[model samples]
Target: MFLGVDVGTGGTRAILVDRDGRVVVSEACEHQPIHSAEIGWAEQDPDDWWHAAKTAIGGVMRWARENGKAVESVGLTGQMHGCVMLDADGKVLRPALIWCDQRTQPQCDWLNETIGYERMIELTCNPALPNFTLTKLLWVREHQPEIFAKIAHVLCPKDYVRYKLTGEYAIDMQEASGTLLLDVTYRRWSTEVAAAAGIPMSWLPSLFEGPEVCGRILPEASSVTGLAAGTPVVAGAGDQGAGAVGMGILEPGSVSATIGTSGVVFAATAAPTKDAHGRLHTFCHAAPGIWHVMGVTNGAGLSFRYFRDTFTPQLGYDDLTALAAKVPAGSDGMLWVPYLFGERTPHLDPDARAAFIGVTASHTLGHFVRAVLEGVAFSLKDTFTLFEELAIPVEKIRLGGGGARGPLWRQIQADVYNHSVELLEAEEGGAFGAALLAGTGVNAWPSVQAACAATIRAAAVIPPTSAAAMQAAYPRYRRIYPALKGVFQA
Candidate 1:
């Protein structure tokens, strides 16, 4: 059995997967979120991540032992862009700045206007978003320069978890790709970018590819997690990289659609290619040497969660989806732009707001729910067009996440994307992907490909069916964003 550990903002999860890729045992531990009382602030305790990870893993191991699954290796993937600063004694200096925290907008804008957009994009393959690690560091530098000055090294969320498991200082390329300090093309830290960001060279850890084994779990960690002490622990990537692996989108030209707390449209590329407008992000894939372009929508599944809370009283996802299925394509001219938490792809505005347009007396609650689903699908298509422009030929796509849970949403995605979307037989997302990386590390399989072949399986595929009217309505949906771009800024 391979153990995959995923440390997310709200919780920590561990899954024990068998040779056939089925989850034999799974466990999770939820933690509280911490934040600054001031405006636009969010933070999580790095120690919370470590505590939750240990508990989740220990729980999974206890269950796996009862289930007769033998532990082989372990892998970890975590929420991206968290700034975990360690004091000289390896203690967390402050609470981790989490992935979705938007307090660094001032730092982000300053970097963009001062350092210049083209230079940063060319260096990092992305804009200086407030969510990125560099921006978070800048926030610390300005707000708590004393703590910043005392930093020994910085690790992303997953890297901090890996330190607990292996007692090693390491990180993966894909995680570093989000930091804005890595020269993405060169696959190393950039001195120019670091100096510009006011970060020192000594603050970063040595980076590795996702599939490589960084070190072995120490006996102390073994005592806590109930795993073998010398078990190989792989240097896992951030959540998105693990999601790509989970969906079997590691091959070139393969595309993945993932929606959990947020949404992502990831297209694998053989060579590194940056989006010309710096609207999309380019990153190294967990698969050795390959790269991927990803466009993130900050609130897809979570938006549905909000809508369900507002409209339906205790209706589950299936009930809501069934209600949506009653409504026809395009929601009968009722268009909903789901930018409630602000848009991410194509338009990089955190200030972007959502609205329902073309509503009439004919539109019902079912129609509204259906419109939300279709709206999310249409938003994903915006990112898909970027992959097309780069000629990153995508045929069929693998779908995962809470959005991928319903057959209705899958069908909507196929129709809107005008392509087939297949589901992974294994349900766990990043956790399972991390286990596959661990399997590769332990030589449990000859390579990452072999592990995937031995374990990963497909569940279902939704193919694009009839919808000439919906296809025609796509242009109108595309225009809504442009018409509202100015309003979004306001």
Candidate 2:
């Protein structure tokens, strides 16, 4: 059996899979609410992640043992772009700056200016954003010099958990790509960028390819989580890369559109594909010897959740989606721009805020809900526009995360993209992908591709329900950002 664990934004999840890739048992433990002491800033306790991971792992292991399964290997995956700092003795220095934190714009500007914007992209294949790890580190250095002086190690969220489990400081190529401190083309840390950013290279972890053994569960971790001591832990990809692996997006021309709190449109590439404008991120793929380009929408399901929390806290997510389904397409000309947490992809503006345009007295709560949903779909289509410009082939589109769960969202995505989207038979997401990586490591399958091919199958395919309405609505949606750009800055 193979075990996979994902340290996510809200929780940690563990899954145990049998030799054939069948899921035997899965468990999740919710994290404490993320601390947001200031607007545009987000933080989480690394110790909390470790605790949640232990809970989930123990739960899954108990169930697996009851089912007569022994977990032979483990893989790890988690949210990307978090900055976790540690002291010389491996004690966490402070709360981690998670992916959604937006307090690093000044640092991003400094990095671009110091390294030269185009030159930075040339070195990292990505433009430094406020959410990237390096920018978060810079924010800490500038704002808390006392704490910065004590830093001895740095890790992304998952890698920090890996250290707790295996007593090793290590990271994978796919996760490293988001740090803005990696030479993605060569799959190693970039000394030039590190020197320019004034970050010490010695603080970085050892790099590994996904599916390679980076460490083994130590006696201490095994005691806490109930796994066998010395169980091999494979170097797993970040959540995005591992999720793509689970959805069979290993080869070029295959793509995925996933909507969690954020949305991402990912396409595998045979080689490093650069966007000279740095509008999209080109990162190393979990599958060795390949790369991927992805565009991000900072707020997708987040917009919907924000509305629910503010206006209809009593209603559940499914209830809101059902209400949204009752509304007509385009929400009767009402449009939503889901920039609630700033925007990524086409516009890397950290100050950009969300808006609801063309709301009328006649509009109902359902209309607002539908508008938010449509707005997210439209934002994701912006990536497709870039894909067309880059000539990145999109032979198949797979939907994952919140977007794949609902019939309404599936149809909405298909209409907006003007292409059919496939749903996987099992949508266990990043944890499942991590398990596949573990299976590949243990030779359960010869490669990640073979593991996915053997286990994953399309559950359904949804085609565009109405192409004309989406065609009409998208142009108006496209106009909202430009019109509000000035207002956002002010």
Candidate 3:
């Protein structure tokens, strides 16, 4: 058996997988809700992640022991771009500014001015964004200099948890790509950018490939998590990278559209693919010697969640989606802009706002709900449009996350993207992908691709049924954003 742990935004999940890639046991422990004392600011306690990881791992280990299975290796994965600072004694300096935090636009501007936008993109294969770790660190340096002064080590969320588990400071190339501090073309820390940003290279963790063993489980972690001390722990990718591995999106032309809290359209590439405008994020893939380009929609599933929580509290997600299913393809010409947390792909504007446009008295509640689903899909389709411009192939599109689970949303994605979408037979997501990396670390599989090929299989495909309607509506959807841009900014 191999173990995988994911330090997710809301919780920590641990899963045990057999040599064949079957998940034998899985457990999760939720953390406290993210604290957002002010708008556009999201923070979480790093210690909370450690506690949840211990609890989740303990549960899975208990199951493994009862089943007479021994975990051979462990892998770690989680949300990317979160800035977790530690002092020389390895204590958390402050609450981590999470990936969704949007209070660093001023810092982003400063970086862009200091390094030039194109040059910054040339170095990191991505532009400075509020969601990136470097900007969050810069925000701290400016606002909370005391904490910044004490920072002796820097790690992403999962790497911080790994530090607790193994007493080692390490990060994977794939996760480091989102830091805006990596020379992604070379897969190393960028001294130029670090210097310009007033950051020290020594503060960064040691970089490793996703499937390489970077540390061993320490005795202290073993005591709390019920694992044997000295078990090898592999460097795993971030949520997007590992989730792609779990979905078998490894080669060029293979793509995935996942709608979790955020939406991502990912395509694997043999080389690092750059977008001159910096719309798509080019990052290292979990598989060695490969790269991926992805576009993010910050408020994909969140759009539907907000609608459900705000207006239809009595209705569950399935109930809301069922209502959406009753509506026709284009929501009777209504459209939604899913910029609740500001836009990412195609537009790097953090000040962008959400809106419902073209609403009429004839539109019902169902139309509103269906429009939200289609709007999120439309936002994701922007990435596919960028993919075409960059000449990235998209021969197959696999669907994952909350959007893929619902029949309505899956078909909606197919229609909006104007392509057939596939579903996996057993999509356990990042933790499962981490387990595959763990297996690769121990030679249970020759490589990440082999582990995926042996274990992952597609279950179904949803073809585009309302392509013409969506194709027509998409142009109008495109127009809405541009027309409302000034209004949103105001």
Candidate 4:
């Protein structure tokens, strides 16, 4: 059995998979809710994550023991771009500035000015964003110089948990790519960027490719987590990288459109593909010798969730989606801009806001729901537009997360993107992908690609039906953001 552990923003999850890649046991323990003392500042305790991981791992290990399954190897994954700093003794210096924290625009601007935006993109394959690890560190250096001075090591949220499991300070290349300190094209720490930012090279952890064994379970960690000591742990990926692996999106022409709290469109590439305008993110893929280009929508599923919670708390998601199904393709010309948390892909504006345009008394609640569904898909379609500009072929698009579970949303995505979308047999997400990496690390599969080929299978495909309507409505939807940009700022 291979074990995969995901230390997520809200919780820690442990999943055990058999040799054939079927999940044998799974357990999760939720962490304390993120502390947002101020708007745009999100934080979580590293100790809380370690505690949740222990509980979750212990539960899964107990189940495995009862089932007589001997865990062969382990893999780790979690949220990307979080900054977790540690002191010389490996003690947490402060609560981690999490991925959603947007308190670093000043720092982002400084970095962009210092490093040169175009040159920064050439170095890291991404623009300086507040959500990235290096920006968070800069925020700390500016505001809490004392803590910054004492920092001896830095890790992402998942890699911090990896340190608790194993006494090694290491990170996978896929996760390292998000730190803004990595020379993404070379898959190493960017000394120039670090030096310019006044960050020490020693603070960064050693980098490893996904599926490479990086450390072993420590005796102390084994006691708490119930895993045998010395068990090999592979350097897994960040959530997006692992999720893409789980979906079998390892080839150039394959793409994935996933809608969770946010939405992302990811495409694997043979080489790092940069967007000159710094609109899309280019990062290392979990699969070796490959890179990926990604675009993000800050509010995708969140739009629907916010609506249900604010207006119709009584209606479950299924009920709301069912109501949306009754409405026509374009919601009678009403469009939604899903920028509730600001735009990321095409517009990197933190001040961007959400709105429902062309609304009238003629619009019903069902129309609103359908409009929200279509709008989120339209927001994701922005990435496809960029992909086309970059000439990235999209031969297949797989659906994952909340969007893939609903028939209405599935059809809506197919129509909005004007392309066929596929569904996996079991979308176990990052944990399952981490397990595959673990198996690959132990020679259960010769390579990550072969492991995915053996395990990942597409369940069904949804073809575009109302493409003409969505295509006509999309141009109008595009106009809404530009027209309302000044309004949102005011």
Whole-model lDDT values for every prediction: 0.84, 0.92, 0.94, 0.92
What tens-digit string does per-residue lDDT give for candidate 4 at 46-103?
Answer: 9999999999999999998888888899999998889999999999999999877878
What RMSD, rounded to one decimal, does every model reach?
Answer: 2.1, 0.9, 1.0, 1.4
Error of 4 at 327 (Å): 1.5
Candidate 1 Cα errors over 4 Å, as ranges = 33-40, 310-313, 486-490
lDDT value, candidate 4, whole model: 0.92
Number of the predicted model whose lDDT against the real structure is largest:
3
Off by over 4 Å in 3: none
What is the TM-score of candidate 2?
0.99
TM-score of every model versus the real structure: 0.94, 0.99, 0.98, 0.97
TM-score, candidate number 1: 0.94
Q: What is the per-residue lDDT of model 3 for residues 333-384, given as tens digits with 9 covering 90 to 100?
A: 9999999888899999888889999999989889999999999999999999
RMSD of 4: 1.4
Task: Tell me the lDDT of candidate 3.
Answer: 0.94
